[model samples]
Target: MARPLLSAHAERRTSVDYPYSETMYASVHHERRAAFGAELYGALGIGSGDHTARAVYDAESLRFYGAPHAAFLFVQGDGEARLAADVGAYMQTLLLAMTAYGVDSCPQGLLSFYADTVRAELGVTGGRLLVGISFGYADASSPVNQVKTERAPLESTTAFHDQGPSSESVRP
Candidate 1:
């Protein structure tokens, strides 16, 4: 299905104006998703530190009212790019799966800039950078929930190759 987006700035306000205090928002949930993320990393063979961001969930508004619930830091390395892609894709899938259980999430790609600080905080070695995913139930009322990000069309992104003996094409 196509993603949803907001039409204008005015439209954004009505989406996130929840009537609860921040403390009240966090208090409604018993799920420790950050801990789950850590455990998930350990089980999947990816090393993770103890860093976690806050996540907000509001059942009435159907919105997660806070910041990220966890952070994962990695150093610069030969496989960093591929590993990041793999990790991002895996996490996206995991979020979608959570939706089946009545949880919603948006991956906060913009928050990956705190690598140096996160590294210092976590005492990570090897001059690696930071990567993180903000996961939580969807805030139906948040303007973010209304904003839609675009994906490439298959025809626009796909490439075809000719093998001479037979024609071959690759899709990515």
Candidate 2:
């Protein structure tokens, strides 16, 4: 069965109105979102108006990416700015460590929607469910694994002072 993502209860349970999210979507975050969306849909060969094909592709992709393991990122604090900042820092550190160990990872906010299910499965009593990461050794043969998204230049997203040498835009 093809499951739709926006059931009525799902909207109530998962949708959150973050204050800065509006500003993000409206301005500073717009370019990267557009670029990423373009790359993603291009990779899937789905045109803008091809909603049916897009839906089928999304459903199939969910099942296709059945990675062996997923790790949830959680915090013992409420959804406060400081706590979310800490979570971001921790996730970055963890992802760096995983890369050093040759493990592939995909951080997922989608998993957090089913927070109740996660808490039940993991016997978690406290802490807010923040996000999850799916990881495994890379399967280089897979086209999905080969897909890459465009990132904004470092200078566009970062600010520098009279600190060190000339800041060069990092490219991957």
In terms of lDDT, the best-performing candidate is 2
lDDT of 2 by residue, 43-159 (tens): 767787898886756544223256677787777756577887898899999999999999888886666665666666678887777777877887888666667876678997789
Prediction 2 global C-alpha lDDT: 0.66
**What lDDT score belongs to each candidate, Candidate 1 first?**
0.43, 0.66
Q: Give the lDDT of residue 142 in candidate 1.
A: 51
Per-model TM-score versus the true fold: 0.43, 0.73
Candidate 1 structure quality by residue, lDDT tens digits, 64-169:
1353354453534566558656666777677778678876555443233334334444576654443444456566675445545344476765898755553455
User: In each prediction, how many residue pairs overlap at the backbone (N, C-alpha, C within less than 3 A)?
Assistant: 9, 0
Give candidate 1 regions above 4 Å deviation: 1-65, 73-77, 160-172
Candidate 2, 18: how far from true, in Å? 6.9
Off by over 4 Å in 2: 1-23, 59-64, 163-172
lDDT of 1 at 31: 36
- For candidate 1, report its TM-score: 0.43
